[model samples]
Target: MKKLLVLALVVLIAMVSFAKEQILHIYTALDENEWPIYVKAFEQATGIKVQVVRMSSGELLARVEAESKNPQASVWFGGPAIDQIAAKKKGLLAPYRSEAVEKVPAAFKDPDGYWIGIYFGAIAFGSNKEQLKQLGVEAPTSWYDLLKPQFKGRISLAYPYTSGTSYTVLAALVAIMGEDKAFDYWKQLHKQIHHYNTSGSACVTQAGLGEITVGIAFAHDIITKGIDKGYPIVLTFPKEPTGYEIGAMSMIKGAPEPDLAAKFIDWMLSAEAQSLMVKWNRIPINPEAPVAPGAVKMQDVNIVPMDFEYFGAEKDRLIERWKEEIEYGM
Candidate 1:
């Protein structure tokens, strides 16, 4: 009896060790607060243990680039599609076409199946209502309004290369207005901006605190924090056409567990996963997925005509121009 008990204990310990070893390493740009729902759901559905590593988009991108020789994470999820596009071009991500891709909009997914769109976010303005009201200033409705002298030192925005949010905003402006007009517009708007942020989401909260009268950020982020906390914030779209981001996912090339990573991509693009994103206040790219309340529909918005292929190709050049013209305060 004693020998039998010892053998059973040994087997149980081995099983536990094996389960731990099988955990999937997931690298994401999502912060801890925004990550819980997706991570929890993934674990519950697959019973696959997950080890999550979170970092800024730039940090993760650089890390992935450095570790290209020996990829660590099995999947790279939740970044701007452009980052994934760039990585794919560099041969950093393996080609993957999830079955769920069929449900997503064709424009949103990669043509070569290198990445998939999970959700979308429109570039919008976040304003501190109290500050605006106190200043007796009406909220800016048009892109030109951002250049008004009254708003001088009252706006904050992210830098393009460091954040996808900023890049989307820049891309949208260029797409909506001709290149000359966009560059000129940014030069004017720069006069009003009080600070440049690293994270796109930061501008939303900063605006809430009245640290800046306005912030350029994704509409979802502004609404999620603004309305809930009653931070006296308001979300507004530009009178002119605007730009948006395809919150995207991709499997890293040379992943340690290709099969498991593929499974994750499939599950993420699934109707079930897309629906979960709506619960967290993200706009589901899947037409079949239900939209969240107060969420802006793509059909209703005047999305600046996008050419993602062009955007991807020109990203480096455009970002360099922005750094020199916008970030360095030239």
Candidate 2:
């Protein structure tokens, strides 16, 4: 009986130790190349185990909504800020204003502190020069150029419903050409689209592989992950103003580990943490943190004026319209 009591005590101690080492779950919209580095750094700094599942921003939001009652993730990281705003409106995010918030620019964060921007990148066309040469097509210089017959069945884009990058493109078009004209533009451009991809970066990858002549994605991704890797792709911004995404992070509402998640948020905003984005060719939200070499400075790009709150509110309506008018008709 005394030996049995010792065994039970040892088992209890083991269980307690296992519970203390419980992993912090993260639902991330960051690319796979970026997340592992972040997870490693975070674990090394905090001594907390992290398990991450990577998905597109829209998919991540859907998962968060589906699991709202019993949240599975402690945080949502590295998605467009507009998605974060939409999540906040749905009460999926917990508001926690970190001390690090003061270090971020006012334009990069939510006014109510539901989410914080960690980085930003601009939308551009990633064209394969060899593919374009083979097709006798010039690199597209404007959004309108994408509608040319030569581009037919050679352009790849992500569906706006499933991709933050594509949503940003839609929002930019509306802001640039007005809503009515933007829809009309998409109808014309639809003819050239070879396929609608689920992942934003996948289109760029296809372009790099020469499977598509042109891909609509973030310029930073095309440059670093595509061209730099000898994929024969070249990045070009539309002569018209382009949209940019302020990639953000937020604490999940009712997260199992809110305190630990908050700590992670604070750490992400630090200069040391933000600088890690350089490894993935992402610009850091903290001004003091240096960007990756070859990153295009925001000032050099003709960025469209984006109203995050307005776009966040209108996303559902716009997506529904796109489905009916563009996707269905296509």
Candidate 3:
């Protein structure tokens, strides 16, 4: 009878361990402030516990690549779709056609089901009005204005090596100007940059605090977090067409919890789930979801033509060149 009891105890322990493994682990590239709300909502809607580690898209990509042989997370949530496309090419993403994919526009998703866009926003400059006024300079109306001697050492931007926002800026410049001219522009702009922050939004935060005169970040993030928060900041787009990002979600290859990951993806894309984007001032990809009141409609903006596939494929080479030519020289 004692031997029988011991075997039963072992079986119970195994069952408990299996149950604990049901928790979903995610590496996210979204703002850290937004993760808790998402986690709480997801856990309440579905019984699955979510564990998230928030980082920049570049950092998430690096971590995912490092852990490819022994995966740690089941999914990557909320990063540029171009980064997702790069991941897909690297064999880091697994193809899963979520039911929610049908609701998403074709341009916002991978043709092969590798990743799906959940939201999108345009890139723009955030200037601290008070700081600009103090310097007796008007707010910049175009990218070239940032290179003026008066703006030198007054701008903040993230390093392209570890920031998706920075990468977007680089790619946009390349699309607006030819590749060679874009590189030349970056070399000149480097002199005006006060610092290269590790996180993309950090620059915006700095500008909001008046630590710097200007910052480069997504217009929506700047408007919501900086301007709406009572900071003396103003959002402006470059006179030339601006670039935008389609924030995406993807399943990691060999995810430990494939079913749970798929569920999370579908839940995020659902109208009810996508509605949460408004809280963060993000534009939802779901057609049925209401957009933020002050958000600029893409149709009204002059958007630069971006070849995501080409950019994704050339990401490494471009980043290396940026480091060698821009960062190194600076």
Residue 273: error of model 2 in Å? Answer: 1.3
Worst 10 residues of 3 by lDDT: 294-303
Report the error of model 3 at residue 146, Å: 0.7
In model 3, the runs with Cα more than 4 Å from the true position are 1-17
- Global Cα lDDT for candidate 3: 0.89
Error of 3 at 185 (Å): 0.4
Write the candidate numbers in order of decreasing TM-score. Answer: 3, 2, 1
Q: Output the worst ten-in-a-row residue range by lDDT, candidate 2.
A: 291-300
- Candidate order by lDDT, decreasing, is 2, 3, 1
RMSD to native, candidate 1: 3.1
lDDT score at residue 180, model 2, on the 0-100 scale: 93
Question: Model 1's lDDT to the true fold?
Answer: 0.81
Which pairs of residues clash in candidate 2, taking residues 3 or more apart in a chain or in different chains? none
Q: Report how far off residue 184 is in candidate 1 (Å).
A: 2.5
The list of candidate 1 runs beyond 4 A from truth reads 1-16
lDDT of 1 by residue, 27-112 (tens): 88765667777888988998887888986565666678899999999788886787777777677888888777787777889888
Tens digit of per-residue lDDT, candidate 3, span 195-299: 998788888789988889999998878887788889999988888999889989999999988989999998998888988888888889999998888886687
As for lDDT, the candidate ahead, 2 or 3, is 2
- TM-score of each model, in listed order: 0.91, 0.95, 0.95
For model 3 the TM-score comes to 0.95
Instruction: Tell me the lDDT of model 2 at 151.
Output: 94
Instruction: Give the best candidate by TM-score.
Output: 3
CA lDDT, every model vs. true structure = 0.81, 0.90, 0.89
